[model samples]
Target: MGSEKIRRWESGALAHAATDPFGPGPVPWLRGSELHFDDTGHVVPWYVSPAAPPGPRPATSPATTPRPTAGGPRSADDVHRQIKGFASTGAVTPGEAIDFHITVDPPQRFGVDIYRIGHYGGDGAGRITTSPRLSGIVQPAPLTADRTVSCHHWWLSWRLRVPSYWNIGAYVAVLTTDDGHRSHIPFTVRDDHPADLLLLLPDITWQAYNLYPEDGRTGASLHHAWDENGRLLGEADAATTVSFDRPYAGPGLPLHVGHAYDFIRWAERYGYDLAYADARDLHAGRIDPTRYRGLVFPGHDEYWSTSMRRAVDVAREQGTSLVFLSANTMYWQVELAPSPSGVPNRLLTCRKRRGPGRSALWREADRPEQEVLGIQYAGRVPEARPLVVRNADHWLWEATGAHEGDELEGLVAGEADRYFPRAALPEHQGRILLSHSPYRDAQGAVRYQETSLYRAHSGALVFAAGTFAWSPALDRPGHVDPRVQRATANLLDRICKRD
Candidate 1:
């Protein structure tokens, strides 16, 4: 794969290029950066740099220092109305073409700058390529069908033929209008290449929480919706289905996206052999979990399809270690269906409570998530609380200097999980409860949270962090915990067989 020649699309034609674009070399642009508007109302490149002598490459492999853009809206209420977009798919392999469908509010020119998210000596991300200025238009208003908002923007704003040399990782396309408004569309580059660890991004859960069009008038998520009387409805009354065809409302970035990015930065900095994929890939049978030594769920992975659950179960049975870095995993039972245009897995349907005898929760369906996770959703924390260490002698806490009954400040918050003593549990040789933190719920009820690790009969190890703060603590500013970081590294080192 290292000797494969890199290719790019130019003026609707394929052109040959160097083998490793990120290697030590002059590095030709994917498409020349110099641009001018042509008579046909299209931007065209006016110059291309000639190949030059190769020099010593940077210390980093394939990452860039992203150029700063004007700060845009911070939330849905302040959304950048000037421009927004969504990718045709959540993940694409190298050498495949991906289409970007965009909408410009007042019909102006816009361009997309691509960047790969990673740890580049703390810069966090690097620019990959930039598209020529494209003519944008006001796409048709999103259509609402059965309480689902979908913007099937058929207009192809830009098509990127991903270079074969592009590394497999998370990438973001920044859509910027001529007026300086910017938004982001994130996608992952995946391949069949095997790695020590497989990182599954919680894309399904992201869509479930997305309230697109956040206009305060028309937008519905699996968690909240607006009634005809202009009142907010809770989860029970929210939309039962969600489509991935619309941009994330507000900042155009999904909730908890930063958590996954933080983990990526921390893990990549250690030079871990990691492969990336979307959660949908697991559901569609596209990812072979057994090929990797460990499978990692890095963020808020709450929703899970039956297929996804079965795949992981089978992988665990075959001795593939599992790591759940966030809480509330595999809580819902969902079904994937084709989009209106026949794209597979574009629509996610989860009837929270279909009828008197049916439910979307795996536990209610008699297949408790605890059987696989070793812990179940306990309660939501009203505020941050200390995480009390229970199994201080466990290998997971090695070199952390944590003593028995030690409390890590503010490590427990958001949703959490706990070991259910009387619940259906999987057959394991040994089990250890790592944390025993108690927190107050929104209803003022005091509940206990527990982080757990268990060894399955097949020799597979499953670790559940039991709190949403685990990933954030790995790299988030103001939340970095050296003890938590050391414990996470200890766990990953063993799972990846690096120890």
Candidate 2:
């Protein structure tokens, strides 16, 4: 639609953007309590910008084609037991075939609708393709070996050969059963083509937190599991590794996935030249971070493989700017392994122990997160708190209209980070603490959070937004802050314009 319409929708004035009339009827699996989806099963999609559209479009579709909204039919609770699936790989390059292994309870037919997520004139997503009704069968139960729950569903229910001309972006495969149940399997379409920015989806962390089956009995993630007595098991007793061969628990969407969606909507609305990749791309050396001016980790990117860490470090050393829009980034060092069939990087392994020669917390491994991010995970905020601005006159805040000590309500929350003076730090020519926010932790003790920006010796700008609320503040309803939006734009603009 028009820019004014997009703005009105973002401000919650427009009730709903006209639906793409091409997709299937509302499915019960797509509905959720998130405000993005309205009562009528249509998605309002997240934030929008009033800026002029970028002159060029990606190769996926022409301007005349109508784009689908970000969501399909979903249930209010997103109960995913009836139908669920997972991609053969977290990402697929153009022209490559990716398999979808699905399980339909009680055996039923289903269809997979693929949608590329973006700003799409405020539609939020464009329906790329839909699969023919495929014969779906219940896959075998997941095998729990060494505390790892893996479903190597070798059934290969459906495979799609990505069109050679498809655009590079995040995509989702919506599994809608014949009975109206629906769920989501998220993946990325990647390419060697270079762009101004590279957005890395934290698929590793997504899988790490995925307690598939979530059914008390057969669920296990790297973070938690069930004991024999049926009591919850914490990290100390949880699975040491997790496999990507299974679908996500509950609604099948990763936790904090909306944060990434919010960012994609806001970024593409401005027509920023953006490319997409999965975290595994960095781990497998499939991505050359130097090809882009900036590398963005949009959500809770808490897990990192050694190779993934090296790639970003080398990219920054070569002057590629880095933007981390959420907190608790790179706190754990993980290792990626192949699945049973020898496919690469399908398994993530992490032992949450602190000691020398351990592949666990990076801080315990002598590589503190602050060494690169300029701040490390501080403590969890029991509730939302104001983000108190500090460097109001800094260039990043030029158009934000914020003043020193101004509190951006409820912007420092969830997990938070701060500068640790005792930690090993990277060399920076200059540094600034942008926000100093204080909130009570779960222990009832007050802890401070800080947003930071620092210039590496190679002239690359590294920004750490030290709070999980930062990304949601950019677009989510009730959390959007104009100051946060403008400051983010300023940071990104500087990244793109810097010599």
TM-score of each model, paired residue for residue: 0.85, 0.85
lDDT of 1: 0.77
On residues 272-320, what C-alpha lDDT tens digit does candidate 1 reach at each position?
A: 8999999999999999999999999988899999999999999999999
Model 2 Cα shift for residue 244 (angstroms) = 0.9
Query: Which runs of model 1 end up more than 4 angstroms from their true locations?
Result: 1-80, 228-230
Q: After superposition, how far is residue 285 of candidate 2 from its true place, in Å?
A: 0.6
Error of 1 at 248 (Å): 1.0
In model 2, the Cα lDDT at residue 296 comes to 95
Tell me the tens digit of each residue's lDDT in model 2 across 275-306.
89989999998889998999999988999998
RMSD to the hidden true structure, all candidates: 12.6, 9.0
